[model samples]
Target: MNPSIKKLSDIAQKTSKTIIGLMSGTSLDGLDIALCEISGIGPSTKVELKNFASVPYDSAFKNRLKAITSVPNVSLQEVTLMHTYLGNYHGELILKCLRKWAVAPSEIDCIASHGQTIFHAPKQQHNQPQMPNATLQIGDGDHIAHKTSILTISDFRQKHTAAGGEGAPMAGFIDEMLFTHDTEDRIVLNIGGIANFTYLPAKSKDRPSITTDTGPGNTLIDAAVRQLFSKEFDQDGKIAKHGSVNADALAAFKSDPYFRKPLPKTTGPEFFNLHWVENKLSKAGITNVSNDDFVATLTRLTAETIAESIKSILDDKSHPPLYVSGGGFHNPVLMDWLRKLLPDITISSFENLGFNPDAKEAVVFAVLANEMLAGEGFKMESAQTENISFGKISFPN
Candidate 1:
C-alpha cells in the first residue's frame, strides 16, 4: 500500500484531524487556502475554519490563465508547464499560509486540493454526439505532496465525472452533509464564477439530492469589467450601482437555451464569457450603453436567472430559506436584487450555519479529505449520479 494511504488510515483512527483545503475557482482570482480543523464525518461531522487566506495570482499568472480561457487552441507545452507550475505554486502558498498562521506542515493530517479547472465540457456543454461528459483540472498532486511534504488528495472532480456527474459542482456533497435539516427545506446557494446550489429537502436520504448550476454568476460580470474598465472585478458592485440596467438587454441575455434547460445541468466561462454577452448586446441593438449600465444589466441577469431557477424547482407556496455563500454575496447590487426577488423566504449568509461564507468551498474539501481518510464512500439512488470515494492520494518523500 502507498505510504500516504497508511498515513490516512492512521489519521482516521485519531480523535481529530487537521487538514488544509485549497481551491481555485473559474474566476481566475487566486487560490483560496483554508486550514481547517475537523472531527467526525457525515452528519456527525464538526468543522472549524481555523485559518483562511486567498493568495492572489500575479498579473503574469492571471494573464496566462485568461489566455487559456479566451483562446480555444492551446499548445500542449503550455498546458504541461502550467500543470506542474501550479502544483508547486499551490504548495508554496500552503507554506506561506502555514507560516503566517504559525502552524507546521507536519502537524497537518492531509491536504485536499480542488485543482485549477482548465476546461469543463459536460455532454450538454459540447452538444457533441457520442462524446462522454469530461472535465479537466491541472495541478500535479504529486508535486503538491512532494513540495509540501504532506499527504495530499487532489483532482476530486474526476470521480464525479466518472460516476456520471458533470464534475462542476461537487459542493453538493459537503452542502448536504453540513446544512441538511430535519424539518425545514433549505437551499445552499454558491455564487462563484458560476452559480450553483444544493437543495436539501426536509427529509434526508442516501440518494443524490437536488443539485445543479443555476447560471452565470460572476464570470460574465468579471469579464465585462476587465474588458471595459480594466479592473479585476466590480468591487462592492459600485460600477453596477452607478448605472441603470438595460431591461431589453437583460431580457435578451436570459433567452439562452442553456437557461431553459432542466435541472442538474452545468455551465462554465466557456459558455458564458464575453462573447455571450457581446452577442446578446448586439442582438438587442444596444451599442452605446455605458460600461456601468452593462455591468448593471449583467448583475440583473444573474439575479433573474437565480430567481427563475428557484421558481422552477419549488412551488410558489413552498418557500425555503436560502443560505448564500461564495464571492457573490459580497456584491451589494446582486444581494439587493435577490432580497427583492426572494422576499417570500428568509435569505441569509452561511455564517448563521457556523461556516464562513467565503471559506465554505475550501472547507468542503477538508471534509472530503476527512471522509477519504475514514475509508467511507457514499451511494446514491441513481447509478448515473455521482456517488463514490473521491480524491486521488499522493505521497511525500
Candidate 2:
C-alpha cells in the first residue's frame, strides 16, 4: 500500500484530526484560512477553530479573479493559468498562517480547500437546453497538495451538482452539526459576496431545516464602490451612510424574476452583476444617481431582501434569533436596515457564539473535510436535494 494512503487510513481511524480549511468567497476580498481541530461525525461532530486568519488579496490578484468570475466570457489562458496559480497561492498562504501560529506542516492531517468560485449556474437559473445544473471553482487540489506536502481535499461542489443540486449554499449540513440548539430556533445568515441562510428549527418543531442563497450581499455594493469611488468596498458603509436610498431604482432592481422565485433557489454575480443593476436603473428611467446613493440603495436592497425572505416564513408572533456572519455583517448600514425592517427579531454577530463572522466559511469547509475523513454525510434539506459527501482528496506523496 502507498504510504500516503496508509497515512490517511490511519488518520481516519483516529478519534480526532487536525485539518486546515481554506475559503475564497465570491467577494474576492481574500483567503480565509482556518486551522481546525475536528472530531467525531454527523450531529455529534465537533470542530474547533484552533487558529484562523483573513489574508486580503492585493489589487493584482483581485483584478485577475474579476477577469473570469461570473463574467459572460473570459481569456481561456488566464482562466487556465489561475487554476494552478491560485492553488499554489492559497497553499503558500496556509503555510504562512501555520508558521505564524508556530504549527508544523507534518502535524496537520489534511487541508480542505474551497477554491474560488468562477461561476455557478443551476438549470433553473440558466435554462439552457440539454444542460444540467452546473458550476465551476478553480484552484487545483493537486497543486495545493504539491505545495503543502499534505493531503488536500477540494472542489467540493461538483459532487453536490452531480447529485442534482445547484452546487451552492453548501452550509446546511455543517450549520446543523455545529450550531443547532434544542430550544432556540436560529437562522444562521452568511452574507458573503452572495448572501445565504441556514434555518435551524427548534428541537420540537416538526419542520425540517434548510439553507438557501438570498442574493447579492456585497457583490453589488463592492462593484459600485470600485466603479464610482475607485475603492474596493464602501468602507464601513461610510459612502452609503452619507446618501439616501433611491426607492425608484430599488424597485426597478427588485423586479428581477429571481426574487419572485420560491425558496431553495440559487444565484451569483453571474446573474446579479453591475450590468444587471444598470439595466434596471435604465428601465426605471433613474438617471444621474450619485455614487453614494447607488451604494446606499444597494445596501438597503440586500437588507430588505434578506428581511423579506425571513419574514415570509417566520412566525409573526415569534422572533427567531438571527446570527449573522460574513462581510455584510460588518456593514453598519446594511445591519441597521435589517434591524428596522425586522424589528421583532434579535440580530447578533456569530462572534457572540465563539466564531468570527469572516472565518465562518473557512470553518465550514473544515467541518466538511472532517466529514470526508469520517467517510460519512448527514442528510440536510438543501440545494443538493440529496444526502452527499463532498471534497476530492489529493495525497501529498
Judged by lDDT, which candidate is best?
2
- For model 2 the TM-score comes to 0.97
Clash numbers, per candidate: 0, 0
lDDT of 2 by residue, 1-397 (tens): 8888889899888898998989999989899998899888888888778998999999998998999999878999999999999999998998898899999999999999999999889998788969988999999999999999989999999988887778988888788878888888999999989999988998777568878888899999999999999999988899999999998899998898888889877899998889999899888889978888889999999998898888877866868889999999999989999999989889999997788888899989988988888856755444456457899999877
Model 1 C-alpha lDDT per residue in residues 1-397, reported as the tens digit of each score:
9765677678878778999999899999999998888888777888888889988999789999777663468988998998999999999999988999999899998899989998899898888969878889999999999999998999988887777777877788888887888777899999999999998887543434688899999999998999999999999999999999988888889888888899978988888988888898898787888889999999999998998898788886889899999999999999999989988979999899888888889998888888877746666443464548889988887
* Alpha carbon lDDT at 92, candidate 1: 94
Please give the lDDT score at residue 8 for candidate 2.
86
Q: Compute each candidate's TM-score over C-alphas.
A: 0.95, 0.97
Model 2: lowest-lDDT 10 consecutive positions? 378-387
